[model samples]
Target: MNKHLIVVTAALLMAALAACPACLAQTAPKRSAPEERQEQKDARAARITERIELVIARFDNNKERHVAAYNAAKARLKEAITELAEKGYDVTRLTADLQAWDGMFVKFAQDYATLINLLRTAEQYAPYESQGQFAAAIQQARAQLVTVRQDALDIRHYYQTVIRPDLQALKDQNPSSSPASSGT
Candidate 1:
């Protein structure tokens, strides 16, 4: 009689389990292909956002170091110019060149700021919904990065070709007043 009761209970449990699929099918709706595609796009956008954040952090660190180096070099150049002037040396050309390079450096800094702002804007865009706007921001940021890099190279070139040579000429004329090189 106990085995007969167990067999009846097991049959009832099997019958209930067989009915669960039809119950679940009605309770939970199936996702269509478009919904699945949208989910995939949203996931991709989230991953891209994370990567952009990491890039921003690295870029900021490098930018701070670059700016600090620029300021230090500018100070050194000014000190050297003052020392030369005090020693009865004509620093008119060196002063002019320094001013020009300073202007270029200022523009370079502005471009870097613009690039960072564009990346920040890109970060603010919504996943999947603002894809076009996000792409545009990224493209603009890439272009700005190119501009900033070119600006840096131009500043280095101008310093090497114009200012360094002028300073070298001054040092050649007076071997005693050896000013430190601008390590830009």
Candidate 2:
């Protein structure tokens, strides 16, 4: 009888321990700090880059529709910068930097458009030597466009890594100062 009672007591104690919240909590795996943060930053940057690239690709793929779309997207980006400036973000400095970048991108796009137009013209005219020249021009424009695209990507990456983190830290430091948080 004494042995049976001891056995039952041990079983009950084990059962109680299994039911504890602390045991459940301790069973879950811990997350690494840096890994989690890097994942979050990568995801955010990917989203922004994807949106910008999609618009650019849409413009590239559909020549007939692209002019309107490209203009609209550019206008929207400009408006966004203006809005950010109005909200007390450093518009002047950022705009100056972006304008320089924009000029490069515009030149690339113009060259690409000219190349495409040349190709179309060559195809319609079907002159042998002109075809070769048009082909060479198209290839050159494509290479330039690739470089411009890479530059834009680099700028975006910099914005994500340097600009965004600083802005986020500022927002965190002064929660009430942010327009979004202030409800103003």
Candidate 3:
């Protein structure tokens, strides 16, 4: 009986040791250095481009919905600006943000454009390949859209908490310089 117990314990220990590497491997984070860099670049670009587009949309149509959207987008823009600033990028030049943002914007826009085209083409021919592509594109687009919306919220908060107060202070300091001061 003593010998049997010893043998069973040794076998169990061996089994656990053999499984350790696989367990460790499964739990480990898999992001490679290049992948991490690319993800950062992509996120940064997405932030800037989405904000700019939202801003443009606001100005293009001054509806209440657009105004709200603009505010939200501005909040995201400010967050991205803060992030880039922290990342040691001089955001003073719109060119830097523009370049990054433009690339991401074009990528996402083209993806959506392709999805639309696929949808139209699928309707005409009913091919499985086109249908599958369209469905996948739509799923990816929806996920991306959620990220874009969250970024917009961050921009709106930044505008409200930081930009608005500064502007208000400037106005207060220069109250007498405005024609509205006459109460006409």
What is the TM-score of candidate 1?
0.80
RMSD score of candidate 2 (Å): 25.0
Please, what is the whole-model Cα lDDT of each candidate in the order they appear?
Answer: 0.85, 0.55, 0.51
TM-score for candidate 2: 0.36
On TM-score, the candidate that comes out on top is 1
Candidate ordering by TM-score (highest first): 1, 2, 3
Clashing pairs in 2: none
Clashes of each: 0, 0, 7
Quantify how close model 1 is to the true structure by its C-alpha RMSD in Å. Answer: 4.6
Per-residue alpha-carbon lDDT of candidate 3 for residues 113-175, written as tens digits (9 for 90 to 100): 444443333333322334475356445546655554544454445556654554344333322
How close is each model in CA RMSD to the real structure? Answer: 4.6, 25.0, 20.4
Which regions of candidate 3 are displaced past 4 Å?
1-64, 67-131, 171-184
lDDT value for candidate 1?
Answer: 0.85
**Model 2, 68-121: lDDT tens per residue?**
554564566567566664565544444554465456456656665665554344
By the lDDT metric, which is better: model 1 or model 3?
1
TM-score per model over all chains: 0.80, 0.36, 0.28
Per-residue lDDT of candidate 1, residues 13-102 (tens digit): 999999999999989988999999988988887888899989989988988888888889888999888877767677878888888989
